[model samples]
Target: MVCDMSSDIFSRQLDFSKFDLIYAGAQKNMGPAGTTLVVVKEDVLGKVSRKIPSMMDYKVHISKGSMFNTPPVFAVYTSMLTMQWLKDLGGIKAIEEENDKKARLIYSEIDLNPLFKGYAVKEDRSNMNATFTLENENLKETFDAMWKEAGINGLNGHRSVGGYRASMYNALSLDSVKVLVEVMSDLESKA
Candidate 1:
């Protein structure tokens, strides 16, 4: 099975061994947008009957040492740096714990606050992206100003969600989530 783990890759612990192949864009949990990381089970490659383009073929890429063509040097380097940083912080388990904590803090605030409501089903809510909306649509402007004043950035929800999205990546601290929770509480207080 080929798994695209673009949004959820490193933010939480996963059993990667179950998949025959896994790929993820670096922008979410790794680094920037120009690079992607792919992991393939060596034995699974060249087993497919269908032909793939040379660059798209995992075996060829592996044989070429992942330099079949000029690589995104800056993105790759930054991703390497991120990986080293994560390793320094005790690897996936530690990062997963922090991510879970951040998600919980923000989700708890969303659930308890009268002014906000979460988009996703409670059990299905993403640990990486907590999508929520203001209960009073008219308060959007007020809450927006509040979060901005609190120095929160990138809290805007996707166009489809039409609310707010608090992305709690592994690199994001629990303190940051607490600031958002505080902003939600402050907004509710004014309600």
Candidate 2:
């Protein structure tokens, strides 16, 4: 039931009320890959006849305020702290704006750079995952070394794509994108 409305196409296409539950791993756009966020409607449960495990029951968790079990204590706590940080930094809207800006900066560079092309189609490109690869095979090693030395980590594309991917999630700042762009520019200039 939890759809990622974060995608560009889902912006106007979503009707949030239709979903009984909405959940997202805070790792992608929210935080490091260890926290999950859940939002559920009060009356959606008990619609099915199948027996539910105690740990698998949403009603139980909801009834207990999501602390039904010990839970991933530190992970949840950190997620709460991150939420507070977001609030202090002018809330989700401001952070989303920053994320959009970073995506734009990275995507614009990808488009203009002849040596690289995005893995996803123009419309399907993910804001959180900027997947691209070197147009020239010879440049892979150089590009890899350059980016790593420039203090850019986790820019490697998924194995299926075998190229470079700059994941500009919410926690990643504009400064990181700038560093990546500089690396790209340097590589292109040398190429």
Candidate 3:
């Protein structure tokens, strides 16, 4: 199966072998959005009967060492640097552990805090993205101000799921999540 793992690519451990192709944009957990990374098994190519252009051909890209045309040099370099950083942090397995801890911290607070409610089922919750909502919709403005004042941003959820989404990526530290939890607790105190 082809998987678009843009948000959780290197943030968690994954069994890539199960996927025929895996692709991700560098913006979320790797680097900038200009670059995308794709992996495909060689055997899977040439199976399609349709004609594939050289630009869209995976085999062609691979044969050209992923330099078929001018690449986003800066984005590629940044992605390489981020990958190296992840490697130094002991690779995917280690980063997954750190990501899990961060998720658990915020999720625990969401469960404990009466003012907030998580959107996903416990068993299906994502380690990278914690979607939640304020129990009282009116309290959103107050909580937004609180988190903003505490130097927290990007907690806004998608329009379809209008609540909050706290992304605990590999690079996010535990202390950051603690700050969020403290903000949540403070909001609860004021409630």
Which one is best on lDDT?
3
Candidate 3 to truth, TM = 0.95
lDDT of 3 by residue, 39-126 (tens): 9999898887999888888898998988899999999999999999999999988988898899889999999998999999999999
The 10-residue segment of model 1 with minimum total lDDT is 7-16
Residue-wise lDDT of candidate 2 within 23-62, one digit each (tens)?
A: 7766655555566666678777877699999787888888
Which digits, one per residue and each the tens of the lDDT, describe model 1 over residues 1-191? 99999887877777888999999998988888899999999989898798899988989999999999899999999999998898899898989888888888998998999888999999899999999998888999999999999999989999876788998877788898999899899888888
Q: State in Å the error of residue 43, model 2.
A: 2.7
Candidate 1, position 175, lDDT? 91
Model 1 Cα shift for residue 135 (angstroms): 1.3
Q: TM-score, each model? A: 0.95, 0.87, 0.95
Q: Residue 62, candidate 1: how far off, in angstroms?
A: 1.1
Q: Backbone clashes in each candidate structure, one number apiece?
A: 0, 0, 0
Give me the overall lDDT of model 1: 0.89
